[model samples]
Target: MVRGKTQIKRIENSTSRQVTFSKRRKGLLKKAFELSVLCDAEVALIVFSPSGKLFEFSSSSATSTTERYRKCIKNLRPSKQMDDSQHFEEEVAILRKKIELLEETKRKFLGDGLDSSSIDELEQIEHQLEKSLRIIRSRKILLFCERINQLKEEGKILRKKNAELREKYEERQLELSIGQQFSSLEQVKEVETQLFIGLPNR
Candidate 1:
């Protein structure tokens, strides 16, 4: 008769647990040794018991096997990290150079550091300044022309007003002169009538 499969569970009793640990440890070590011998391979195994006792097995020298494992892991480290470091350094150098150029340009604009400039640099600066000066002078001339035109318009308006006022003044003077002449003629007629009335011979 085929027996039922055994149910696997942790042993509750401390003594039974310890006994199971011992048996399993031996079985694992024996299997590791058999596999290494049959396959002609290197193998290492280590276990620690609940009682703090150490157990180990190795087909070769354990220390040498551990050292070899460490070396292999070290060799497997990604080479990309070194490449990234080199790239970062190159970018930093480029940024530093850019910053230096910007500082020099700023100094030139402030007119503080021109002694070290080459002839070509001086010529370039002079050309740039001359271009700017030309633009400023052009703008200034345009503004002056606009102001002159405005003043001329205002002068024309003033002259027209002055002509109208002068015409009005001349008309007023002519009216006053005509009224004085009429008064003078009436006075002469009055004097003549008085003379005729006062004279005896008619």
Candidate 2:
């Protein structure tokens, strides 16, 4: 059967907890000693039990090792801070130079700082301006063509509407003419009925 993984929490039973602590403490000290020997390095470890008992290990004298550690940390802090400060200053200087160059280029483009410019530089600026003008003219022509096509479509729609209106008007005029002719025939019939010859009944 596969063993279950142990949960990492405080052991409830005092006896078990004590046994585990003792075993782990011995293992930790052994590992520290091996590391120092194999790597030829300075190593130190300190542990305190719940009963206030001190347990410690050091590759050399504990006092000397701790003092050396303190000195190394103290010496490294200032130099690291100085290095960061210098790096920040260098970055700021580089950015300032870039900004200055951009501003100078803008001035040259505006024809304000050309006293020191060479003939080649002036010719390059002129060529750039001509290219820009060509782009603008091309865009304008495209807009004009699009507008003309839109107007032509509108004219076609208007002509179609005019033809429809003319057809409707002609139909209405024909209906009126037929109604007038029918009314004239009805009047003639009435006049003939009224014209009886020479007989009067009292």
Candidate 3:
């Protein structure tokens, strides 16, 4: 008869639970020991009952086997130190190349490395310089024209003010001249009357 699968629920009775724990613990230790002996492998098992009694088994010294496992895990994993060193070396190489490129460019801009450049590159640089110069000259001419126009406007205003001042001065001078003429005529008439009066009394 095919036995039905055992339902794997918790044994609720305290006596039954303790008895089951003892049986299972022994079976587990026996299996661990047999596997170690048959396969010539290191093995360790530890179990504790509900009352805190310890049961254990080891094919080799438990401490030695645990240490060996740790060493094996360490050897199987990659080294972070080596990876960091390699990454730093790669970054240094990239920075060095960048510094070299920047230095070369700086030398070119300062007109110190033209001999190393190709003819085409020199022509391109010359063309760019010429274009920049032309644009600068055009801007200078426009600014100068604007300044000249502004100065011309100022000169026109000054000329108009000078003409007005001149007219005012001329009008004052004409008034002064007429007053002087009237005073001179009055003096002459007084002098002639004095001479005629003195001569007629004689």
Candidate 4:
């Protein structure tokens, strides 16, 4: 029968857990030693047990190997920092060049630096200016049209008001004329009555 794979988990029993720790620790140390001897490599291993026991292995003096590892890491940090600094400098240079190009383009747009521009560049600028002018003119025309429409509406309102005022004035005049005619007829009747008050002159 094929043997079943053992499930790896924490051993709850103190004795069993200690036994497992001891076996694994020995096996790990043995592998470290073999790897160092077979590959002629510098190897270091360290382990701390649950009981605060220490186990360690090294192909050479442990303190020396640790020092070497620290020095190697320290050396690698400077190299990486230098690479990063160089990259930063390169980025700064690229940005500076871009800013200069943009400033030059701005000067050209403002018609300040045309002596250095080629024929094609001049033509491009000319085209851009023409397009800008066209846009400006179109906007101007639109504003004029809106203003004209606004004035037309205002004029129509004024004309309507004037017509209303004229109608009111005509009605007032007609009322005044009718009142004067009635007053005149009353005066004429009073004069004739006074003249025939006593007797006729014949």
Candidates in order have lDDT scores of 0.90, 0.92, 0.89, 0.93
Model 4 clashing residue pairs (backbone): none
Pick by TM-score: which candidate is best?
Answer: 4
Compared with the true structure, what per-residue lDDT tens digits does model 1 show for residues 19-120? 889889989999999999999888888898888999999999888889888898687647766888889999999999999999997788678799999999
- Tell me which of candidates 2 and 3 scores higher on lDDT: 2
Question: lDDT order of candidates, best first?
Answer: 4, 2, 1, 3
Q: By summed lDDT, which 10 consecutive residues of candidate 1 come out lowest?
A: 190-199
Q: For candidate 3, what is the TM-score? A: 0.44
Model 4 Cα lDDT, one tens digit per residue, 25-88:
9999999999999999999998999999999999998888899989987878777988999999
Structural similarity to truth (TM-score) of each candidate: 0.45, 0.48, 0.44, 0.50
Top candidate, metric lDDT: 4
Please identify model 1 stretches exceeding 4 Å from their true place.
1-106, 192-202
Candidate number that wins on TM-score, 1 or 2: 2
lDDT of 2 by residue, 111-180 (tens): 8899998999899888988898899999999999999999999999999999999999999999999999
* Alpha-carbon RMSD, each predicted model: 32.5, 22.9, 32.7, 27.2
Extract clashing residue pairs from model 1.
none
Model 3 misplaced regions, further than 4 Å? 1-106, 189-202
**Which wins on TM-score, candidate 1 or candidate 3?**
1
